[model samples]
Target: MRSLCLLFVTAAALSGCASVRTHQGYLTDPQLVASVQPGVDNRASVERALGRPTFMGQFDNNDWYYVGRELAQVAFGNPKPKEGTMLHVRFDPAGNVATAENLGLTRVVSIHPVGDKTPTLGRNRNFFEDLFGNIGQVGSVGQGGGTADNPTGGSGSN
Candidate 1:
């Protein structure tokens, strides 16, 4: 009984270390992808064979993309992509498939945003300044109107 209890605890601990694998975007089929021959298959034919693309080009309608990503997530952690594929299919002016290219995870680049603070012109004010700086500055003129300091109805200065 003692050994069985230890085994149960060990199994439980091991299970915590396991990560969940996930597949996102289009499910790739190698045979079907191979059957899509460039210069022969048009947009309609390709759609019939492989279904609609994951996304179309933003500016140009002739370019199609089929993106796939495999991610792994540990308990209480964010999911991270371990592998990914981007299939770029470009169509010619005649509407037939012109080229098909496969891009791998090696092309992936991650960009982290600077911070929550947005950069703007003028001086940076503190929390107290933001809360109380404009207390006595406002006048009866209202926004875009003139103040007592400047009767010309401008922003008090040139």
Candidate 2:
């Protein structure tokens, strides 16, 4: 009886171990997705089957979005992706399916590139001048103190 109980407890504990989940959260079944006729599957029907979208673009109103994000909650930790799926549904002028693109992690493009500089048209200004220009007497050639000739507000101690 003792041996049997030990075996049962071990089996139970082993069965309780967490198994990583895959292919259940995002990215609907490829076969099922392929079966969906773009225009035939109305907006409400998709929502009923696939829940809410992750996001909806404003300027590009034609495209509807569905996103999944995962971040680690612990401090001093590395966050890993739990599950992410993107469904970009594009509609034509007649409200027909222009395309239903399933973009996954492989398809995602990092908008932030390394050493990427913001495009600028105007000339750059002096950094110190731009930062501390207004802190002190900027008009006095940036020199400390002022001459007696101009005493309106040279001391800067109003």
Candidate 3:
């Protein structure tokens, strides 16, 4: 009975560490993707064959993109991309397919931030400087004959 209980506890603990895979965006079909031919397939036919694109180009409407990614995550960690595919289709002025290209995971980029705070060129300030830095600098009566109302550094007309 103790052995069986131990086995159950071990299984439960191990299950939490198992990796989970998720597929996002377009489901790729190699045969349908290969069938799309430049100069032969137009916008309408491509849409019929592959359905709507994942997204269109931000700058140009003639470019279409079909993106797919598979991410794997273990436990409570962040999901990382395991596989990625991007299909780019460009259209000519006459709406004919100008080019079709497939991009792979080589284009994926992972960035890790250096620290919690972003680096800046200016000098660093402590808690006291940040709290009391602007004490007498603002709204003083006559540091240089300038008040909050008359900030031109000269006498007021009144």
| Candidate 1 displacement at residue 64 in angstroms | 0.6
lDDT of 2 at 109: 62
Stretches of candidate 3 above 4 Å error?
A: 119-158
- lDDT by residue (tens digit), candidate 3, 86-148: 999999989999999999888768788988998887658899987987677674645674544
Each model's lDDT comes to 0.86, 0.62, 0.90
Off by over 4 Å in 1: 1-14, 114-117, 137-139, 143-158
Off by over 4 Å in 2: 1-35, 69-75, 111-158
Query: Any idea what lDDT model 3 has?
Result: 0.90
Q: Which candidate is the best by lDDT?
A: 3
What TM-score does each of the candidates earn? 0.74, 0.44, 0.74
- lDDT, model 2, position 142: 38
lDDT of 2 by residue, 5-95 (tens): 9999998876655353434335555664565468677566566656666666698766777665443333334444655667787777665
Judged by TM-score relative to the true structure, which candidate is superior, 1 or 2? Answer: 1
Worst 10 residues of 2 by lDDT: 69-78
